[model samples]
Target: MKNWMKIAIGLWIAAVLAVGISMPIGYIPGLGAKARIIYFHVPMSWLAVLAFFMSMWYGIMYLRKKDMKHDIKSASAAELGFAFSILATLTGSIWARFSWGSFWNWDPRETSIFVLLLIYGAYFSLRSALEVEERRATLSAVYSIVAFVTVPFFVFIMPRMMTGLHPGEGSPAPILNANGKMYMEASMRYVFYASLIGFTFLYIWLFNLRSRIGLLSYNNHTEID
Candidate 1:
């Protein structure tokens, strides 16, 4: 199979695993229904982190290479990151509503992720307002890199420092806490990891497609000139 086809198949398998195994695990006669959101919410948060760092990496590359393609890739990754972040927030909110008695809270993790969304929304606006390709690329690259500096602080440091309703905060152990003590059953872990891999592959596939379309459009415009 072609590379894209392989990726598509892998993603399909992952999606199937997420859907098929999530309920069984959640209904394990004791864990209760709140566990259902885990399949979607956890993967979304992981992908959001992956997407943002990928964007930052490409942004740095754009600066080093002065290649517009790198800028396009960086922007595409950022867009995807923004999307996953929103999904993570929404799903987290739903989970919180059921598990924490509120749909929204002023928790540090919540506030920080929301701030990230705003920062990236501003990024999109900044990119749109500029007409010159080189200027847009340069400005966006710089902004992406700079904004990424906040990601480590918000997603990592701040959450650790403050008390929050979120699970990972204030614990010596990682929030994910996937050690044997808190680990999902083997069968469930299979499905969960599959979902993670699937979403990650999907992100890459979409990024490549977007990058190709961007390159084609650029070429078409250049041809007309």
Candidate 2:
């Protein structure tokens, strides 16, 4: 990422935090004041899914081309995806504590996210167990692709299919609803979308920086051999 772009992202996120914290939003049904976390939680969840999808994409590229660069990129994406998933989980759990009066209730959405985390966690374990580079790359790629196949079902379908305290129950959440409609005020909606955009840009920057670091390590090992 360029210096200017990095600075812009920093400023943009600061602005998002400022507005999201201060802006007067209409009363949310179940969550009144705590609804502000939506700006961070939803976006982080989105980027987690996006990162996993990109991991699968690069994995496919590696399988097709047999290039180590794609493998590195795929691994980088998975690492970020895992990190973001943890963040999403933590944020949701905190929200649950206030909204549902407990840290965890095994709600459908919470269970699904937990399952998603286990699946990706195993992916990393699989990568570490293999000693051969080629085998590790191939297996990791295949695992990422197959694992992603379950992502939409778990992240999107399962939560809505079953009742849950984490929204998507008979009642709707603040912004994202399973009924295919968003119920946010105009100003809040704008901030929500802007936050999404800022986070997307931040993800791109982090991904690029991570990919470069991975490539550097890979190249140095190649040179040593």
Candidate 3:
């Protein structure tokens, strides 16, 4: 990201924090004051998915181009995806304590995310177990693609397929419904979307920095070899 873009992201995030905290959310039966978690939790989850997708994208690019830079970018994206997914888990667990009376009730959403985390966790372990740069990158790239295939099923499909405490069918789904329509109050909607956008930009900046670091490390390793 450019200097101006970084400054803009900072401003946008500050605004999101201001509005998300100050804006009075409308009534949500189980959530009440705790509903504010959605602003942070949902967006983090969204970022996890987006980052993982980018990982897959870069992985495919690596396979086609046979470039170590693309491999570095792919690994960077996976690292961010795993980190964001952890944040989402924390936020969701906190929300669950309030809404579901426990930190983890093993709800479908919780189970799915946990499984997703494990899947990606294994991805990192896979990367570390391999020593050869070309072999590691090739296998990691293929694993990234395969692992992401489960992402949609784990993050989107599986939870909804089974009963879950999340805002979805047969429950008082707030903000967004099972059909993917937003029902948030106008003010809340604006702030929520703005927050998501800001989170995305933040992810982009983080990805750029992480990719640069990965590239440097990879280059140094190549030189040493």
Candidate 4:
């Protein structure tokens, strides 16, 4: 198999096996049905944060080096970050519908994620609107760096201050216990961690592919000029 195909297949197999194992473990007497969402939702949210931080890191590099490759990397990471954030929001919304009796309630947590979605969407729009390549990169990089300032606030601060329907805030004891440790059954933890690793690898693979494609397209267009 081609290298990319091999990587893709490996990721698929890992995802499938993880989900299969997670389902049975999630059905264990103590764990319950809601545990299933952990496999998807938690990983999506985690990966989204990871991707955005990566974008910011590359953004800094772009500014320092003024290299288009760094810009491409930053842009690719933001695109993937946006995708993961959307998935996280949808999964959270669905989980809420079943667990909280509504799809959305403008809860601080939900509202913050929605804001993140809008910010990233606007980033893409900003990219599309500009005609000059260097200008587009610089502007978007600045926007990304500024936009991520809200991430820490939204993901960490706002949730803690308000007594929302979400799990983390206003509880003496967190949903996950002290030490931030969770008590997933062995099987579920295995699969859940596997899913996390697989998803991360998939993100890296996709980001590299996207950056390469962008570079190739840029080169082709320049050749035409």
Candidate 3 structure quality by residue, lDDT tens digits, 7-90: 999999998988888888888665677777777888998888788889889999999999999999988998999999999999
Give the TM-scores of the predictions, in the order they appear. 0.84, 0.95, 0.93, 0.84
* lDDT score, candidate 2: 0.88
Q: Is candidate 1 or candidate 3 better by lDDT?
A: 3
Candidate 2 residue lDDT tens string, 83-178 = 998999999998898888999999877787787789789999999999899899999999999888877787677776777776536767655566
TM-score of 3: 0.93
* Residue-level lDDT tens digits of model 1 in 1-225: 268787676768667654755446533432366666666777888877788888889888988999888888888888888999999999899788877789999788788778878987989999999999989988888887888887777766776677777653444332343242544567667666777677777777777888888888888998999
Return the top candidate by TM-score.
Answer: 2
Residue pairs in candidate 4 whose N, alpha carbon or C atoms collide under 3 angstroms: none
Candidate 4, residue 154: lDDT: 76
Worst 10-residue lDDT window for candidate 2 reads: 167-176
**What C-alpha lDDT do the candidate models reach, one value each?**
0.76, 0.88, 0.84, 0.78
Q: Higher-TM-score candidate among 3 and 4? A: 3
How well is each residue in 1-225 modelled by candidate 4, as lDDT tens digits? 269866775867577665654455534433257657777787788888788888888988988999988988888888999999999999999888887889998887788778878988898999999989899888888988998887778766776666687654444322333357665568767767777777777777788888899889888998999
* lDDT for predicted candidate 3 compared with the true structure: 0.84
lDDT of 1 at 132: 96
